[model samples]
Target: MAAEAKQSSYDGSHVENFEFYLQCSGEHESILHFLMKHLPEEFERIGADKSGLAVLGVGSGGGEVDVQMLSLMQSTLSALPITADIVEGSTELVAKFKGLVTKTDHLQKIPFTWHTMLSEEYMQKTKGRGDVKTFDFIHMIQMLYYVDDLTETIKFYHSLLNKNGRLMIIIESANSGWDTLWRTFSKELCNEILPVYRSSSDVLASLKSLGLKYEEHFIPNTFDITECFDPNSKTGQHLISFMTGRENFYQSFTPRVRADILNVLRSKCSTEKEGKVSFNSEMRCVFVYA
Candidate 1:
């Protein structure tokens, strides 16, 4: 029998690897730029008639990006009281987020309710309840790939928005190397139990199918994947594992399988220039309105 393929979530033991991948890929810079350029105007419009703004961060890992977003909202609507609800599944990430909040004085002013649970669980608990909270702004960034049902999850989040509210989602774009990689090796690398092999294209399709109004923006980005080709580099291995959504993938897969993946990555997923490989890490930001 063949070995069972397993998918692992980022936790204390492996979250550092994910962070390293982020640093190498420079995805956060693009995300920050997009939010800075777009979120302030939206915040102004959303808080125009409201005394306060309610925000939700779904799968808000470590809260670094979340804080930046909240700060922008504060600056845009200086007098509007802002409260946030955070839903994250990782306990380690939740602790780190809490610690970050304590260190940042501005974030301290905003009241936050933390739920150390998955977005699905949070949705289940709040959906159909009479007193369920609604939000003026909600963000689900780079976290939809792990959800069980992309369409249903998007629908649930869309339903949580108040009038004129927006749900911002960031994910890998259709033109990204991730789309090529997953299309080529989903059976080997993707999570079979969940809809993990998803990209912004899928999100758009789901939005259109559900007849939801949304605006899409593409952010062009690249990843320095030179380390990924180095067989003996621990960082390289971690990057590969993070990209594939598999823990310790270099050690877990057979040598033949690993070689095939590497070949595909080099030939089909990245471009070579001056002996360095640059993987296309383009991202898309979608704003769904209620």
Candidate 2:
């Protein structure tokens, strides 16, 4: 079942896609800024309580960002202890992150409970086993694309938070290149079993429907994907694969569809700024309280 899930899922097994996307995108810098602005307040709250904080990281690929957040918390809170529940669907990713934990001196200090499973699978296991663990902070960083049901998953996680707990989600902003690309692909190819691509607007609407109050911040970014102008370039292909969640979008889609997609990407999805073909993305950060 795990093998089947990985095969059909666009994100769980796309380690290369994730890596390529990370290389091209300045998302980490934006996230770092967001964290620096907000984490101090979170640390103050946790410190005042004087109790160990609990964290849940969904789709925590390679633990790079997770460790960053923890490191920030440590520095800001003066080494307040934390118990983190790390949830990742990809076995390869989980192993890579575990390797980091073993080798990285800083990551060694924070305690972690690893769940090598999808968010949905983890939720099911918890429900079946009657586990009622509540986390003070939870995060799903740029990972909603893989989930089958966005609203339900958000609600479920919200329910698992203790009082004053927070759920932080990062996703592409509406009308951005990433948003345009994913919405088009989803309209063309989404199905009951496959992943559905959605933007931060979709998530915000869901929260609104649930009558939940939330906060949002936009992180502006640009990636120079000029190489993608040449459709045959390796970088172009890699960027397409990462954007479309396909191994080889040109080979997988019909010529007409692929051409249309390329046209959208080269035009509607990008702009020339400072003489460089830049993919403009506004990543939205949503914070929900329980």
Candidates' lDDT values, in order? 0.82, 0.76
Instruction: Output the worst ten-in-a-row residue range by lDDT, candidate 2.
Output: 1-10
Q: Which stretches of candidate 2 lie above 4 Å from their native place?
A: 1-13, 189-195
Candidate 1 residue lDDT tens string, 1-290? 00112113557656776677778778788889888998888888788788899999998888889989998888889899999999988888888899998998998999999998887788889974789889999999888877778899999999889988999999888857888888777777755544357788889999999999999998888888788888788888778877776668777789888888889889988999999999887889999989
* Per-model TM against the reference: 0.93, 0.89
lDDT accuracy of residue 23 in candidate 1: 80
- 19, model 1: CA deviation in Å? 1.7
Candidate 2 TM-score, true structure as reference: 0.89
> 1-290, model 2: which lDDT tens digit per residue?
00012322434447667776777777787788888888778667645665677889998877778888887877787656878899987777788888988887876878889998888898888888766898888999877766778889999999888777888898888888877766766765554544566788889999998888788988788788777657679988887666665667677789888888777877888887675788867788888978
